[model samples]
Structures are given as structure tokens and as C-alpha cells.
Target: MKARDLIVLVGVIGIVLMMVLPLPKMLLDILLIINISMALMILLIAMNTKEALEFSIFPAILLITTLFRIALNVSSTKLILGEGDAGEVIKTFGEWVSQGNIAIGLVVFLILVVVQFIVITKGSERVAEVAARFTLDAMPGKQMAIDADLNAGLINEQQAKERREKIESEADFYGAMDGASKFVKGDAIASIVILIINLVGGFIIGMAMHGMPFKDAANTYSILSIGDGLVSQIPALLISTAAGLIVTRSATKGNLAEDLSTQMLAYPKLLYIVAGTIAMLGLFTPITVMSTLPFAAILAYAGYRMQQNLEQKAVSEEQLEEEQQIEEVRSPESVINLLQVDPIEFEFGYGLIPLADVQQGGDLLDRIIMIRRQCALELGLVVPVIRIRDNIQLKPNEYIIKIKGNIVARGELLLNHYLAMSPGYDDDSVTGIETMEPAFGLPALWVDEAMKERAEVSGYTVVDPPSVVATHLTEIIKKHAHELIGRQETKGLVETVKEQHPAIVEELIPNLMNIGDVQKVLANLLREKISIRDLVTIFETLADYGTYTKDPDILTEYVRQALARQITQQYSIPGETLRVITVGPTLEKKIADSVQQNEQGSYLAMDPGTTQQVFQRFQEQIGRLVQSGYQPIVLASPGIRMYLRQLMERTMQDIPVLSYNELEPNVEIQSVGVVNV
Candidate 1:
């Protein structure tokens, strides 16, 4: 057992000793033992643990056991007035009782017992309340994971049964505590009735013990000690025991047991102190305070203090709420102002062509050309031309080159199986991956050249690429892994993450099952082809139809093949030479905003070369739309308006810049028919 438990055992023994011995002589020992036990118990129980059973049972058992022991020793004869040597001691006790000392003793005993009972019942109810609140806001993903686990045959029926049982047991246990909320009203009446019974019993018993003739009139001083000690000790013990039992029975299985044992061991210290002090007062001094009156005054003072503290706590809470409101009002602006460059300027990309400025379009390609003209009109510079390459499977050389290039730059260039399986290069050749290396090196060299030119030119520009850093990946892993991964990986990864990914270890994420990088790359490919439902269905089948965990990589490649066929059909762009005219600031802002809002951080600034790559991504999305049997077209960013003007000027530059006020008469009418101008 714990040291606190040991201390409680000592206290119990000491209390038993005090009751058996003469009261005044052993009182100090009793008080000392009780106080030590109470302190130790409180300290031990206050430490948070997975199982929280200390609150309810401890108070009940401790107070009741102490009270019961004390009650057995309580006698009316101890308070009777007499004229003899033993009678002198009795007279002294009577005088103490006549004074307020006995009342102090009685109230102390009663309060300890009543409070214990309240703590037990109320504490249990409080735990239930907390559990209910916790369950209410639990996410749908948590339930979904449980369902997935069941379907996957992870946990057996018995284990599931036990889990439900535990949940229900906790619920019912707390429900019982709600009934205990009514016990406070019962305690008030019980206390009053006990007081009356004790007073009447004490009067009769004291008269008989003192060997005095039964008088109808009461000896107020002599009967007072008897009334105080009897009522306080016996009734208090009964109430505490009753409360403990009620709370214990009502609480979840095993809840009350721990708390009861603890309380049974701890609370008697207060009683011991009160008992010792009252005994000391009787022995050492002559007293004149009224017993019941002092008790009543103490009770009133305690009530007042409780009320004051409660009011203060409420006021503190209100002030904290007001402070939070004030902080919230300023926080958003503070976050905005903290950045030196305007966030809005960064949100909108530099360029896109709007269609209104375009002269004419007769086909799908012509329509795209019109969009290009619109972007030139809106932004001052040449529009960056995007050429989409849909469903182009990466050769092994391409994968190796991308991988090596990414490694040099401390980044990852992930490739799906279609790329690995592509028959563009023979693996037997020296530096088989060397052919892939050129794809990235050429871009890097172009970026370097552009950077140098931009330094020389006033309006030099380039596009930015996507930011896929370790920090972002860590966050995704923590959130999605729980939903995606199964038991073995979950158990292993949880520990691995704690050691390696300390930043993300605590995050509750969606599980991702066993398929790793291969699956991610495969999904990216499928994202370009299949509709969302088809992709979800394919993954479900891969998990259910075949052996999944052993070779997820191969399964990933297979899925990518199905995705590749769809990709080649819808958006196959055929081109080699690409042209790009970098756009100006105003249109850049508008386009960037559109991308930020619509896509999930997919668009990032890059070179005119990177624009071609972005078009490829767009082609995949458009392909998915087409295969799903929808006519798909990229919505030109607003920045395209400026670019359209340039395109028109190259074809026919005589037209003036159109104003919003002149749209109906100047631009729209001219496009519809011959204009008077």
C-alpha cells in the first residue's frame, strides 16, 4: 500500500486507542494522528491519474468510521454536575459544555460527516457530467474509424462488446450521482431530527446516571454536553456512512471502492482535533460560553465565507471573459499588420487574360487563344503561356532524374508506377537515370538565368512553385495516419512518431492504412482521371479484394495504370515550343487570389516554364471532369484581362483600353456588330 494508506491505518489505530482510553489524557495523540492522515490522503488523491475514484468514497468512509468510534464512547454521565472527585471532572466537562466549547466540538464533528457525504455523491455526479460533455463533441471521423476497423476484422466481437459495456457502465454510474443531488435537502432535516432526539435522550440518560430524582424541569448546563456529544458523534457517523454507501452503489463499477477505502482512512483527523480541543478546554480552564450559540455563530460565519468566495470566483470569471473579448477584437488586425508586405498583394497571382478584349474565336483552341489575349489586355507584360501535358507516364529515367534532382535540393520528386513502367529507356545503359536528370536541371538553369535578368531589368518576373516542406508533411501525417493506417502501423508509427516526429506526436490524425508513398503517388495519378467516387471505390476494392499489406507498392502501380488510360483520353496537349509574357502587379493580385481561394494551395508562383507544368496539372483536372462526361474548361484568372489586350495588339493594336462606364457602348456593342465609332 501507499504511505498515505499507512498513515491512515495509524490514524485508525490511534482513534481506537483514544476512544478506549480516558478522553482528556489521550486526546492529543488522537488529534495528531487524524490531522496527519487527512493531509497525506488529500495529497495522494489530488494527483491526476487515468482512473479517478478518490473523490467520492474517501470522504464517506473516513468521517463515518471516525464518528461511529467517537459515538460509542459518548456518554451523558461525562457531562453531569456532581460533588465528588470523579464528579469534579464531570463538573468541569459540564462547565465546558455550558460554555461554547462543546458546541464548537459538536459542529466540527457534524460538518465533517455532512461534507463527506456531499463530496461523495456530488463528486460522482460531476465526473459523469464531464464524460457526457466529452462525448458530445467527438468527431464523425472517430466513429468512421471504428466502423472501418470492424469491417477490416481488426477487433473481435467480444472486445467490441467489452468496450460498449465500459461506456454504458460509466454513463449509468454517473446517472446515479444525479439522484444524489437531492441528498442535501435530506441532510438538513436529518440533522434537525437527530439534534432533537439527542437532546431528549441525553436529558433522560444524564438524570439516571447522576442518580438524581427525575425532574420534569431540565438542568440546562448538565444536559448540554450530553446533547452536544451524542448528537454530533452518532448522527454525523450515520449520515456519512449512508452517503458513502449511496454514492458508491450509484457510481460506475469500481468507482466508489477506491474512494471509499481512501475516505474511510482519511477524514477522522478533523474530528480528532475537535474532540481533543473540547477535552482540553474541559480539563485546563473554567468556561462560560453558551454551547449551542457558539456553534450557531461558527456555522453562520462559514456560510458567509462560502458565499463571499463564490461571488469572487464568479466576478473573476466575468472579468476574464471581458478580457478575452477585447483580445479577440484586436488579434486579427494584429496578425495582418505583423506582415510587412501586404498579404493581399501576395494572394493574387501577377497575371491572367480576360475574354472581353479578344476580337474573335471560332474553335476550342481559338477560345484558348482568346483567353490569352484577355490576359495580355489586363496585365501590361506578355502573358505566361500554359501548355498542359496530360497522362504522360514518366520513364524510369525521368523518375531517377527527378529523384536525384530533388535529393540535391533537399526535396522529394515522387513518381507513380506508370512512370516507372514507361519503356522510354533501357535499364542496362550506363547512368540509366541520367536521361531523367535533364528535366529538372534544365528548369533550374532557366530559373538561374531568369533571376540574373530580373536583377538587371526593372520589371523582371518569374513564377513560384508549390511549398511541400517537412513541417507540412508532418502535420498531414499526424492527422490522416490514424484514419488511413491499421493496427500494426498505428502501434509502430505512434512510437516512431514520438521519437522522430516529436512536433506531431500528440496530434490525433486520420488513419491511412499500410500503403505509403507508392499509394500517394498512385492516388495523385488517379486524381487526374477518375471521378471522386471512382477513386474511392477503387481504393476500397484494393483494400478488400486483394492482399493489401504485403506489397502495397505493386497495388499502387496497378491503380495508376487504370488512371493513366483515362488521363490520355481527355487532355492530351501536343506542343514543344512555349511562349510566356510575364504579367503586371494588378492582374497578378487578382489571379493569385482566385487560385488561393479555389485550389487547395495547389498553385504557387514559378517561372514561365513552370506555367507549362501548371497547365499539365490543370489538364488532369479537366480530364477528370471530361471523363465524368462534363464539358470542362479552365476558368481564366481575372489577371488575363491585361494579357488579352497585348494579344489583340499583336493581332490588331489600334483599340483603346476599355473603361467600366463605356463597356455597353464602347466594347460590348463593337463586338456584337459594327460600331458607329
Candidate 2:
């Protein structure tokens, strides 16, 4: 065993032995001073711990210290009664606290008992019990979140395991603390009992055995009892306070002093208010000027200094940013850097800067964070960090959205105005500048504050500038989501699946298919606005069919059939019949025959005349579906579904095309219209 380990084992045994052994005055005094010093060290260590887990051994330490103090008490009691004196340590404590008055010393010792036992110990015990219960209750939820992140490719297997372990440690620590607190409580009660016995027993012994008078016996024993109690109880008080600090400590980046100063003195304005209030007390109240003036001046000085520091910090950050930009422009690798592109980018003109600037009340940045979370939940796609910047070449109110460094959509906004779409019919009184809502291309007007309330009352959909921008950006991302995912992103998803469902990934990847093949399959599903969130089922389907075919198109069809329930839920109402446009016998037969195969893959080889005919018929059916307020879903047979989708993908990319096999058996499908040539 290690020396440190052996020393700890021996020290615990020695603490127990100290209760039975008799000691000389000098040796006893050394032990008593060591007891006080250890207690102070424990308190300092507790104060410096950033979290309770950082001091996980505190419960064991608490038990050992309580035992040590109890042993010291028993030894002192024996010495005071048998020898008529404990030690120089006890005698000095007795004399110093009493100052020749035993009654005052008794009062002081009782007060320490009340503070440690009733206040600190009781509070610490209750806190430990509550913290233990809460930590256990949160365990399942924390574990589920870890699994979710692992599946989402947000964290690796090792990270998830570490997080789970930390949660367990938290529960165990608090539970141990709950039980160890009783030791301190029992020690407090024992200290009071021991003090009473020492005083009473010593008095009787002094008169009966030593032949002393009542006055002399009482005087001699009272000082010894008070002194013993004071020495023991003071250290007990310190240990109990340390226990409270450990139980109440939460996870923080810094120690107690740093957290207290950083959080409490965070707001300079609050400090200024406090200083002014203290100054007013001196000016108008009965409090003396000298008493309040010094404190008020100190507070005022602190606030002023804090404000200056904040301004200096802002200036330093701006200078640093400017220097970095200049260095980047001057470097030879600047051209290489320019070749890289962000997955998504949002650039706005000067007039719309406030929409991204936090100080100007812009919540655009916060909304984008929510947007990423929403996309992750809905589409099972991890949207990258959106690079936002200002473009000087654009108009003042103009903003553009980009995908892979190419501009995809642009819109203008008046930040102070609301975009109000009309309620089927226009109200003559509600008026502003005419415009178009960019997301859906609906006719709308930019109305100021005065017209906003009136428009809402008139049944118009009133939306602020930020909401307009957010809605447009969300739609753009959803439309172009397929372009954002690639082989690297697919590897992340594959690795995530390997953490939990290893068998499926190992069977399919490298042997039957590779990362690029999987990426294509996922992109194909996302192109039609299908969610890839249920990756387990998707991987299972791929593993079952990947050996038979290498085509992503064929593989996506198989995967879609596996996710029939999810796809059905996406398009079908709970009880209502699914209304769709069905391909007629003539179109299906033509599409089936037009599907030609080659070395690369299959292609629709229909002539222009037949293709134009099919397009016109589709337009007629889709227009009617839109007029009737039904989504335009093209339902076709399984064999020709892929071909039919390929024919219309370029012109009607937003519309969903479903195969009959993709629908659930329970859903009732009604063909509202049929398309044929």
C-alpha cells in the first residue's frame, strides 16, 4: 500500500484510540491545536471547491472529524474529573473565554451549540436529502438526452458515457452527505451532555474525595467544564459550517470568492443606485454624516471604476477585430481562405443591421438558434453555423440568403414596420406601402405601428419585420436542406448509429455500401421533404436490401416503404380521407414504357409531345387541387413513381410525390382528381 493510504488508515484508528488513552498535558495540548487547525483547513477547502463533486470525499471527512472531536472530549472529561485539571490547552481556553466569570463562559458555549446544531447542521441535512432526491429523479431524463445527442451526431460515445457517469456520482455524493450529517447532529447533543456531566461529576468528586468545601468545589469544576466545552464546540462549529457550504454549492466555473464578486458586482447601475441610497440616508435621515459618507464614497468609486473597465473592454475587442482583419487581407493565404464557403450565409444591408445586432434589440441571432434546433428535431439534419455579415453593394433594406456561397433568395424589410397580409378581401381603411410576403409570395403591405393594431382588428395577419425575415429564412433552409448534407455529414450520422445499433451499420457499410452511397440515399429522401430522423429504421432497411442493389434511387424507395407510418403521418389527417391527384391508366402505362435502362441508370425517354401533354394535364389537376384547398400530392403506382417524380422534379420541386406502397394500409385514400393525356 502507498504511504499516503497507510497514513490515512492509521490516522482513523488513532482517533478512536485517543478516547481510551491517558495523555500528558503537553501532548494533549498539541492534539487540541491540531484539531482546530484541521477544521480551519477543511473550511477553506470547501470554500475553494468549484462544485460538490470536486469535494466528493467531504462526507467521509466529516465523519472522521466528528469522531476525532468526540475522542478529545472524552479524554478532557476524564482528566478534569480525575486529575482536577485537563491540560494547559483546556485551562487556557477556560480562562480566556470565562475571564474569571464562569456564568458568561457558559452562555457563550451554549450559543455556539445553537448556531451549529439548530442552524447549520439542520439546514445542511435537509439540503442533502432534497439534493439527493432531485439528482436521482433527473437521471432518466439526463440519460435520454445523452442518447438523443449521440444519435443526432452532436456527441460521441465516449462523451455520452462520461456524462452518464457524472450524473451517477452526483446522486451518490448527495446520498452519502444525507447520512453523514447525523454524525454532526449527534456530536452536538453529546457535547451538551458531556459538559453537564463534567461539571456535576467534578463538583461531587471534589467535595467527596478531595475534601473541598462547596464554594471551592463549584468554582474549581465550573471553569474546567466551560473550558472543555469551548475548545471542542468551536471546532465542531467550523466543521458544521463547512458541511453546509458543500451541500449548497452548485457547479460553477470559479471558486466562492470569484463567483461572489463576479455575480454580485456584475451590474454597475445597481451599484450606482445603492450608492445614491446610502448618500441620501446621510443627507436627510438621523444617521450621522461620518457613518454613511465613507461607505457611500466607496460604493460610488467602485461603480465608476467598473463602468470604465466595461468601456475599455469594448474598445479593446473592436481594436483586436480590426487588427485581425488587416492581417488576414495582407497574408498570402488570403486567396486560399476566400475559396472556402459556409454551408449557409445571411447577408443584409446597413439599414437592416439592427436585425442581427443584439444591442439594438435584435433577437435574430436567438431565433436562428431555435431554427437550428427545430430543423434538427423535424428533419434530422444538423444545420451548420449560419455566417451573417453586411453587404455594401445591396440596397439599404435588402437582405439575401445563400446556399453553398450562391445566392438563393433575397427580400427587403423596413425594420420599424409590420408586414400585414390581407384577409382574402382588403379593408379600405388599413393602408401602407404595397409589397409581397417573400416566403409564400402572398400580397401584403408594410404597415407602421398606427396601422398594425387596426389591421389585426380588421382580420389581417400582422407580422413584424423580424418575423417576416425569420419565416422567409426558415422556408429557404427547408427547401434547400438536401444541398446542405454531404458525405462528411453522413459519416457523422453513421458513427452515431454505430454507438447504439452497431449490427445494422457494420453489416451495410464498407461491405455492401460506403459513406458516399449513404449520403446520396439521405439526400434523395430529404429532396422530397422527408425526415431522416428515424435513422435506426432507415439503417435496418438499408442493411436488408443494400446487397441486392447499388442505386440510391432504388434504395430510397425501399427505405421509404420501411418508414410508411411516418410518411403517412406527415401527409394524412387523423380521421379525414387523404385527397390526392392520381395518375390515370394511360399516363401510368406511358410512364412505365418510357422508363429506359442503361449502364448508368434508368431515364424517362418520352418524346417532347407526350411530355408537354403530361405537363399540361398535371397543371390542370394541381390548379384544381390548390383551388379546393388541398395539398397537391401525386400518387402513382410503385413501379412508375420514380420515373414520374423525375419528370416533374425540376418544375414542381416543392410538391410531394408519393408511391402507393409508401402509404399505410389503415389510411383511406381518395383520388380527388386524375391526370392523363
Best by TM-score: 2
How high is the CA lDDT of each candidate model? 0.38, 0.92
Question: Which candidate number maximizes lDDT?
Answer: 2
lDDT of 2 by residue, 1-677 (tens): 99999999999888888888887777778989999999999999999998999899999999989999998998888899998988888888888988988888899999999999999999999999999999999999999999999999999999998999999999999999999999999999999999999999998999999999989888888888998998999999998998999999976788889998888777877888998999899999999889998999999999999988878988999999999999999999888988899999999999999999999999999999988998899899989899999999999999999999999999999988999999889999999999999999999999999999999999999999998988998899889989999999999999998999898898989888999999999999999889999999998898889989888899999999999999999999999999999999999999899889898778899999999888888999999999888889999999999889999986887778999999999999999889987
lDDT of 2 at 564: 91
Stretch of 10 with least lDDT, candidate 2: 19-28
- lDDT, candidate 2, residue 417? 93
lDDT tens digits, residue span 90-175, model 1: 33444454454555545654565455446644554454455545544443445556667777899777776665555554445444
**Weakest 10 consecutive residues, lDDT, candidate 1?**
343-352
